[model samples]
Target chain A: MAPRSIFLLSSSRVHGYEFLEHAKEHLKEFLSKRKVKTVLFIPYAQSDYNKYTELVENTLKPWGYKVEGIHAKSNPIQAVLQAEALFVGGGNTFVLLKALYDANLIPIIRERVLQKGIPYIGSSAGTNVATLSIHTTNDMPVTFPPSFEALRLVPFNINPHYLDPDATTCHKGETRDERINEFIEYHKKQVLGLREGTALLVEGDIATLIGDRNAKLFLPNKEQAEFAPNSDMSFLLNKT
Target chain B: MAPRSIFLLSSSRVHGYEFLEHAKEHLKEFLSKRKVKTVLFIPYAQSDYNKYTELVENTLKPWGYKVEGIHAKSNPIQAVLQAEALFVGGGNTFVLLKALYDANLIPIIRERVLQKGIPYIGSSAGTNVATLSIHTTNDMPVTFPPSFEALRLVPFNINPHYLDPDATTCHKGETRDERINEFIEYHKKQVLGLREGTALLVEGDIATLIGDRNAKLFLPNKEQAEFAPNSDMSFLLNKT
Candidate 1:
């Protein structure tokens, strides 16, 4: 069976946290109705010795839910297989990628999340892993791992930490928009440019943007426009 | 002592070829007085082996200069150390990066080109390597190599193949400009947005644009503007 759904958060900025709160609400509702236990997985949490896991535990424990922290090695394939609801937190995308490759857990995690219907929630690095490839990650290539292949959970790419151009620094180098446009021009694939507080909630064949404001939609040879959150499923469906 | 000047081509596109021609002119002028020999390094020239090299060799041979093809493995350090004038052709940035890291050649190449002043030329992957990092490379992450550290010959990033928005596809993604803007916003670094048919020719502290038209310059928090080739030495000075 497919997991309940997949939630991709592009960043961990303040707005990203708010989106997490919204996701928590939905998860709580789903768990209450299903009468089942839920588990949140934070792979990068191990680096900080349960700092992230404790935060999630504290937030969800009051809702009568069971939260456990799986601090396995960089690759936690076994732990991922056993989790019901997996929530990956935000951190360095390159580090997360290295861990996934070192453990050879990319394929396992993808199968569990996509095929086993493991409701997965990812932010930052987690969100990057959900894409067809992690080529669009903004993190510097400080260290290269074995393979750049991502989870390929979605066909499009993800550009987290999407921000508007600062006119003052616009002349310093290639604007963020220009760099992403180069990718769009070359690949002609759909890429979700999620602002700090926005997310794409995908269930089955359905994807809805959940957040406070409209996210920017960029298409090849077209003028960029802002679309309200949860505006339409057309864009998501067309790409998928 | 630094070798004579070199030209870096951004791609093999028609525009890229035109830029190469323009670069050839400058290289010829620089060599005329000093009798400097020129070599074209086609790292991506895997199968079609003789086509690009022959073309470049034939073109420059008539000018009383010896033109040779480099067929070494992807060890960028070796390639840089052995050559006087280097011309890097564009193909796949990821592949080029993989080769550079596999041979552990990044640091040595950086030293030879940036510090020792080997006349360096790069286009496409070559140009991408000239930047602080390859985070803006448009290639997919099919495989991860050992390191993502680029030559960092320049302080800013490079966004080659910069194109305007297109509307024909149903794909929704971030624009090229937007992507670089995002990086600038996060890192406060400058990025050179080089359109097709544009090349950056650096000689000592002088980095000048060469080609048909002016290239776009993007800086964090500043308005993007077009500057004529060799318009100002201030930007290039800061980078060196």
Candidate 2:
């Protein structure tokens, strides 16, 4: 089987940058390495697929790649099968997963990315579905999917745009750490809390954290540990 | 049938107050009117039901009410049927809902509160389950229940401990308003964002906001609205 190449980003826009400005360099380099020219974009996370697709197209066009949304294609599965690369943008996780299930594209997309080794780029909600399940998502359950299970491309779950608790704030809501702890109490899987401006790049058995921020890792029955930028996180890729 | 009496609080502990201290007087008044001497506390939300029940018991001990945890009872449904009042505390909504379904308590609890008119009190996770569904909760989906369909005690959804967007923060996570909008976009139901320290008291057909702060209301296509302390919120009770 071919090795998987996946770029799971915490968010599209970061502090003091335009849309995807922070990750542009890394994204360009990743695509360039594979000589990927045409990209199939999944815009099902947003309510307006046309608008979302147009935004992605504009962004990728300037990077010297042609982008086409799966929504406009007559057959979404065929689009995935024929694509040079796949890009799934961020929005609502539940909406994105439901749409993938509705289109019956999860297995095909998984095959293309896992078996064929097609490059995959995902941000926020897209990053969420690349994991084992959407159980760690911060988004509201706007819509119900048939199940919380996702692509399972990764052994662990990803909590994208993970926020640190404000010690001074009087808010009584559960902190991000508390929520993650609650999740681990129920599910035995490890969860990686990817702060904004960070991305995890996986090449076969190797996984690395990229960007200027640190990522938090939560393992069941263990204290949360932090990983700095460019830290090797391949241990996360090991089977649970 | 007795008139329904319910207090749906945003949080158990508010700023500069001990656990349930700020809500003490109001809770006392609500229970006093109903002449409720005992409360069957549902502590399934928290992992340690015995400890959770102890906390509630200590808090309500001075308020002149006996508290018993449903978990300790051999028959949870029988305890609910015989209780003079019910109090569901805050923790994880998904956990609490799944436990309710697992123990087959939803139907009996609904019949007791809606038809028999037992005084019901809920805080945070508890408040989320009292509504039509748990879709608007801010908690993580650590576990999956049979369905997101809740007790349907009220027509509208409750978003407890609702927070406003930080004006100067660069975080890209969806704001509370944006999440609520996404939910309404799909569910066609009204959502009341209960700010910290506030609550809704329902006495039969009348519902009133009680506390120092204002609560925000989101209707599908209408401009978001706010309600001040003591403001009438009976419109939310009207069926969608």
Candidate 3:
């Protein structure tokens, strides 16, 4: 089954922006279109679950989002099943994946979101989990997960908060491009380098690039192409 | 047994320096003092193992040490057992760890170097494999390993190529300091941030920080401290 609605944001907050402020209107529109009443915020990525949940709830409260953290629930899997919509906030991807595994909620979440077409919104680490694997994440492996396998709602993985390589810098660390190329070298998955303030909204088979920045599609051993904002990236939903 | 003699370098070359050129004199002095004749080079971190091996060999050739790649040996364990010294070069830590696990050479190498006191030298990703775990690495997880567990040669892990947080940079990505802190938030192990042109020379139980730049030590929930060059970092070898 294709993903009904999956909004993958590059970050929760862009430069000079409030926490997920730019995404609030799009998020409300998305949820409204789907008639979503209840939104479950997965605060798995953050170290402080309470703080994360409170902040998220407060941020979306003005937009009329009945936001509640899954961490506050009794049975996480059941929470996912009951959630009208899901919003996963960003932090460390490894810790987030580990939390999913620890709660044994991967199967249920996949069923609830992918199969049932429950609207899912993710940013940063959250966006990483909606993809094929968390291998392309820029976050440190502060914790180990059961596996790098994600929901696989989309065929390709996302490299969020993507920054272009600094030409003048002599930093020894591999740039986003080099890291993604290396991933492509070993893995067959194409990676979407989604810059800040950008997102990919996947509805069934179509995935569209949102925000002002051009999304870079990194194909293995192939030249990367940039798609302008609001462009039809639906082709990404298809397996290459 | 604790690591008898382990020289872990942050990188093979600092900016403006030749391959391992900065540490060449130190390497010669280390090998000469130990009276080591044969050094087995582990080029697993690099994709092109042949080139990595030859480059390392040529770099150390002037010092009159026999540097050979372990990949060329029929029985790697036997080669490790007979080796007077071991050198692991840098590239990708994930690839290096994966190779170590694939070859099942972890135990043998541990036995030879950590237990038998065979001198070992590793730069960048190679140095990461000598720590308690590779959880603090700055490299990409291009490949998955059986576990992040390393040789446990040192009490704590080392964050190689540690860069000072640039105050002027507008980059949204987490700084090296932030990454190390995040690692400590979830993990109990301390992290030694070894900067470029820096090396940690461990003999018996004494580990000394060698380089001109000040190395940062990150302890969980504790303020990070900068250790001046050539400071006695032997306390790091002792488990807290």
- Candidate achieving the largest DockQ: 2
Using TM-score as the measure, name the better of candidate 1 and candidate 2.
Answer: 2
State candidate 1's DockQ: 0.11
TM-score of candidate 2 versus the correct structure, residues matched by position: 0.99
Clash totals for all candidate models: 64, 0, 1
lDDT of 1 by residue, A1-240 (tens): 754477787654442243256456655764565454767566551246377777777777787877777674343666787777777776556667777777777788788877887777788778887887777676544345566668877767777766777675312234557656656655666566777667877777778887775677666553577878776644564543
Q: Candidate 2: where are CA atoms >4 Å away?
A: none
How well is each residue in B102-209 modelled by candidate 1, as lDDT tens digits?
A: 766678667777666666667777788777777766544434545555777776677776665556532223456666665565467677777766677667767677
* Candidate 2 residue-wise lDDT, B1-240, digit = tens: 878888999999898898999888899999999999999999999999999999999999987889999999999999999999999999999999999999999999999999999999999999999999999999998888989989888888999999998888889898888899889878777899999899999999999999999999987784689889999999888886
Query: Candidate 3, which CAPRI tier?
Result: medium
| Per-candidate RMSD, Å | 9.4, 0.9, 1.6
Judged by DockQ cut-offs, the docking class of candidate 2 is high
TM-score, chain A, candidate 3: 0.97
The DockQ of predicted model 3 stands at 0.63
Query: Global lDDT for candidate 2?
Result: 0.92
